[model samples]
Target: MHDFCFAIPYGLILMTGGVLGYAKKGSTASLAGGLGTGFLLLLAGFLSLKAFKKGRNSYLAMILETGKPVFGYRGMVYAQSS
Candidate 1:
């Protein structure tokens, strides 16, 4: 129902995946992508959650969540190119 509801878990998953990837394969890319995007998602989630509590919406959170797909797509494209 709310962006924060999903974003928080998704962020945590990404962060965990990244750490695991690095640990298993020593992939800096995975670590960077996971931690970086995960942090952003987490931040956005919290921001939106905070705003929701105040009966307001956070455009920043919306923007970040909306843009995540694009960023992930780009990451895939970049990985393929390399």
Candidate 2:
């Protein structure tokens, strides 16, 4: 799936454009846009990292507690009853 494939590229472009605009034209809008976007990216990264750690910890806990593998598809949890 090409999901989220363009995120980084577009983010970089926005940042570069912002810097260029701020440097060449001295536009406050450009500076604000870059700062805002940078903040958003940072937030997204933080949230994603948190989510990944949470999921990994949960999976490991489940495996250790149940001694059975857990499975899921498309965010749907499937617990196998032993």
Candidate 3:
């Protein structure tokens, strides 16, 4: 699911390129630019996901160490007295 979320933007970009290629009567430059944009979008999304995961793990660790509950759809951990 996460991977699909990441792929959607790039897929849209590539689709746009294909459309432009047909529209421009098969211009190679337009196709190439579209591919490039798609690749860059994928790369950016990958990096963002990596950063977010790293930050989330660190935050979870902090909360656990402080004995605080981490609440979400995930299971809750009740805080323990020091």
lDDT winner? 1
Please give each candidate's TM-score: 0.93, 0.45, 0.44
Candidate 2 per-residue C-alpha lDDT over 1-82 given as tens digits, one digit per residue, 9 for 90 to 100? 2212333354466678778889999999787767556444444444444545566323332232232112213223423332
Report every candidate's CA lDDT: 0.95, 0.49, 0.51
RMSDs, each prediction? 1.0, 16.0, 17.2
Q: What's the ranking of the predictions by lDDT, best on top?
A: 1, 3, 2
Pick the TM-score winner: 1
Instruction: Tell me which of candidates 1 and 3 scores higher on lDDT.
Output: 1
User: Can you list the residue pairs that collide in candidate 2?
Assistant: none
Q: Sort by TM-score, best first: what order? A: 1, 2, 3
TM-score of 3: 0.44
